[model samples]
Target chain A: MAFEDKLSMILTIGILTSSALMLIGIAAILIQGGAAGHSIKSLIAANTTVNTRTLTLQDAFSGLSGITAIYLGIMVLASLPVLTVAALLTRYIGRKDNLFIAISATVLFDMLVAIFLIPYLLH
Target chain B: MLLLLLVAAGVLAGFIGAITGLGGGVVVVPFLALYLGVPIAYATGTSLISTIATSTGSARSYIKERIANMHIGVSLEIGTTLGAITGSLIAAEVYALHLQYIIYILFGLVLFGSSYFSIRKLKMKNFVPGKADWSTKLFRLNGSFIDEATKKKINYHGRRWLLGLAIMFIAGMLSGLLGIGSGVLKVLAMDSAMTLPIKVTTTTSDFMIGVTAATSSGIYWERGFLQPLLIAPVVLGVLVGARLGSKYLVKLNSRVVRYLFIVVLIVLGSQMLLRGLGVF
Candidate 1:
């Protein structure tokens, strides 16, 4: 079978895999009986009041890790198609470096998804 | 309000990561935990995904340039891919055994090793690369690249054999578990053990990174660690940043890049330690 055909198959696999995981996590929350909803506690480790929390003087980051993980997972399967295309581009088109550029393009696209796609999803 | 901030952070981290050859995961993992109120475990998952994505950006370019040795890369990839499956399984075992301290120690060592090489290799850039030995003769680990500054082509040789594969296996295992590019390990495997030159080692390391990412990506996906909510911004940011950085490589200084690379690793490594300790 062609790489493209396999790629689409893998993508389906990725979607099914990720969605199942999310559902499982969400189900864990449901089973926890409102004890573990996707609330601030589910997302963040600490509980700081909005007004009185001490702000650090330096450029300390207000990290976005939970959301970041969600997006990172999303990007992988998303990039698989790009991975397939990159492979094809190198194989039939470039004929020079072959799988290398394909992998690079696939990775680059994964990063881009993180930068551009996450905000809308949160809302 | 927080959503806007995350978008901005994603963009900033991606730009810095692309220019430096640092994994976008290295940038995003901490940023997500500290700024966006993400948990350490989730951040790690996101970071791993971004690392896979960002590495591929360079993988494409390197391959396009024929800078990557595909045969060696793919051959080594088999080891990495299988190692990844085993390592991912081991991640669960390690976590269950509560031997997370071991992982922290390992991360620290890797950081120190990368720093030493980055520091030490600065002055040795001009040496003549030695000839291809038994490995290059047997496995034929050889390549050529156009020197950007000189506009002249530089050829490299990887003349060792048995040792390089061993290094590749070790590198792959570490890479799968840690979510790193393992570029340093790949370089060590190629340059020192296999007798590859510095240039070829870097390019080959670059080439090898994507396979490492792919290896773990499969498991991360299998375990349901990947989520769309996190993957989008980091991947987009990395793609743009990598492109910008690649375009600017000719004008950049290698030493500065190397230094920046070490600094980021140190910061990220510490963050991982802190998170693992449950202090942050």
Candidate 2:
């Protein structure tokens, strides 16, 4: 398949998966009446301390609760762009498009640094 | 009830954004921060995440249509990603210092400035390609797309790669700082500096926004600015609304929509500025 076709497919699948997880998470939160050990009211409160910084990905996955599902969904959504860039990098490498390969690699590298390195450095 | 209201706001922002070609992030931040009284940091985080939804949701069609130039988008991502990282760090500092007023003022200025681009876009027609310089050849910044409106294949090449990249960096910074897609600046960089086609710029901007937002979203996520409960409804609503709006975009008179949204931007921009100045 063409690169564009692959990209479109990746995007479509990513969005569908993420949205489904979010909706299911919401439904679960409503049905279960709470998530991540917090009541619905507290969870949705403006000044609530429950956030990604407080909730680890391990915790988000350890329980099948609504908040965890939503966290997983958000993770999937956030990864889509990185996935797209990685795909682009692979395609460019396959075609031996040196300039484009470099461009794609640089972008992917920057994103990885932001995602992984910056957090550690900040702390 | 709050969840429902948040969803409704997302839908409205997405609808208006789609029709206006502004994207949802522009509308999301102001509404969430100003009207809903969400903190600026969280509002921007939510807006950034919701932006990814709109970007990914619309990317399929844009990519399929081949109006979006992936090569250009990827190239530009180099600048935007770096800018996003810097901007996100700056935002973290600003928020920490309780200097959110600066962000509000900057966002207001960005909104007010975008009106000029929107009005300029209305007057723009029949793009003529400029002389392709060395950077264009080196970067391979040329592509041809079949214009649906004219049914003619339009071949175009970008110039001033450095200038476009510089503008893209600033665009990326604003996106990370303000939690917006910063499509206006991206479009301006491509449309004016790079001299690409409007269709190409708009579509390519859409393609690039997800990666740009994602770049900063990582920082925001690490900072705990991403609230799962707050973001879920907004993302879902924006995806739905943007989908519906895009489907109906061809049928609606875009000029009318643009005029209406320009007014909205002006009002929102002033409101944010006034709020920042403690006048509201």
Number of the top candidate by TM-score? Answer: 2
In model 2 chain B, the worst 10-residue window by lDDT is: B246-255
Judge candidate 1 at residue B152 and give its lDDT.
Answer: 77
Cα-based lDDT at residue A43, candidate 1: 35
Give model 2's TM-score versus the native structure. 0.94
lDDT of 2 by residue, A32-121 (tens): 999777888878866677888887677777778998779878989989999999999999999999989889999999999998889878
Writing each residue's lDDT as its tens digit, candidate 2 over B1-280 gives: 8799789878876676565456688788888888788888888999999988877777667787787889889999999999999899999899888898999899888988977777776775558788899989888899998765556788999999999999999999999898888887887799888988766776788778889999998789888888888899999998888787655543544356557657877888888888888897
Stretches of candidate 2 exceeding 4 Å from the true structure:
B19-21, B248-261
- CAPRI class assigned to model 2: high
Q: Give the alpha carbon lDDT tens digit for every residue of A1-123 in model 1.
A: 644345335544554454444334333433443211144343323222110012111111244233333333454444553454355445534546544454445444533332334222322
Q: Which consecutive 10 residues in model 1 chain B have the weakest lDDT in total? A: B222-231
Worst 10 residues of 2 chain A by lDDT: A54-63
Candidate 1: tens digits of C-alpha lDDT, residues B23-54: 55556756776667754344555666666555
Which residue pairs in model 2 clash with each other? none
